[model samples]
Target: HVTLVPSHPSYAVISENKRQVRYQAPIHQPLVKVKYFYGVLGSPSITSGKHYWEVDVSNKRDWILGVCVSLKCNEKWNFLRPENYQPKNGYWVIGLRYANNYCASQDAVKYSDFQDSSRSTPSAPWVVPLFMTIFPNRVGVFLDCEACTVSFFDVTNNGFLIYKFSNCHFSYPVFPYFSPMTCELPMTLCSPSS
Candidate 1:
């Protein structure tokens, strides 16, 4: 029996050094959430710098997966920012990580293992306040890492929205950056995600 549960998020499992992954669901089923599991390819040479990581969405049929509306970084050790500020169209958020090369050093790893009994939850912001509002329906969130910068832009055109953040708080070694970056406008202002 195949049942859809709201608690179960869809996952995309990717291998190291792979550029693309695909997910196919029954034409009748609808997917609401997406999760990804990936491992960065390690380089033996100390000088091999990091590479920009990107995830792109492709539509196969009339069934469409909407643009990424929300993002959350998975809190894990060796995790870079898992989430990123949302991009509007065809663009990707790139250049996010601490170590310059694979052989240099590993990013700080958090969360002992999935089952470590002695686990510590990182502290949250002191204010616990809401973020700023950029568009009527969507809000823009930024992260500032001294090591790298993340930029987003429209895929159709070259127009870019460059966001800079400094001293951003991230607990994971590799931040699983998620983006809840979406627009409020329906027909005119925004194009369909598919």
Candidate 2:
């Protein structure tokens, strides 16, 4: 089991028990439009080897899960948007939007088909619609520091692979990140079974 680090007091309001967290608006109130709210980091940064953890987001409508290089201090409020949460910004995360759409933090690329004359660019990092029609209540995160890979799993869905980040460059130690978005329900970190 891992402990949550209440790193962003303004962005992430942690519960007293430290098992749950809720997203909070910025205190400074920036003018720039923020697409994605901030989140808190888990304790005991992973510097090497492999680690896995789970989060219970059964009650949340919108949430984000993955890892980040470092948590931003509460004193400094940077107006962060969805585009800024990519690996380049030290964040490797995937999230569920309110509409139940899943997305990852990746560079937008255009895809063209040889037969079709249509060209499309993915606006959000690898946006994928949930075809299974069943959202996972619990999420599993696996990180391999040596392999530079981070993978997410739908624990409630027979441990199905939700998303994966490969060939990642972890310049700094990474910690588990969680965001409940605007949902009032608290996102809890699950304990290992005995």
The candidate that wins on lDDT is: 2
Pairing residues by index, what is the TM-score of model 2? 0.79
Each prediction's whole-model lDDT (CA): 0.24, 0.74
- For candidate 1, the per-residue lDDT at 163 reads 34
lDDT of 1 by residue, 1-194 (tens): 11111112232222233322223233565655333222222112112223222233211111111112112322331122233222321112332221111010112234664558588733221111112222112112222234433333323323324233223233223222222111111111122221
Q: Write the per-residue lDDT of candidate 2 for residues 7-57, one digit (tens) a residue.
A: 533667888778888776656787564565767778888889999988988
Candidate 1 Cα errors over 4 Å, as ranges: 1-17, 24-51, 58-144, 147-149, 162-166, 175-194
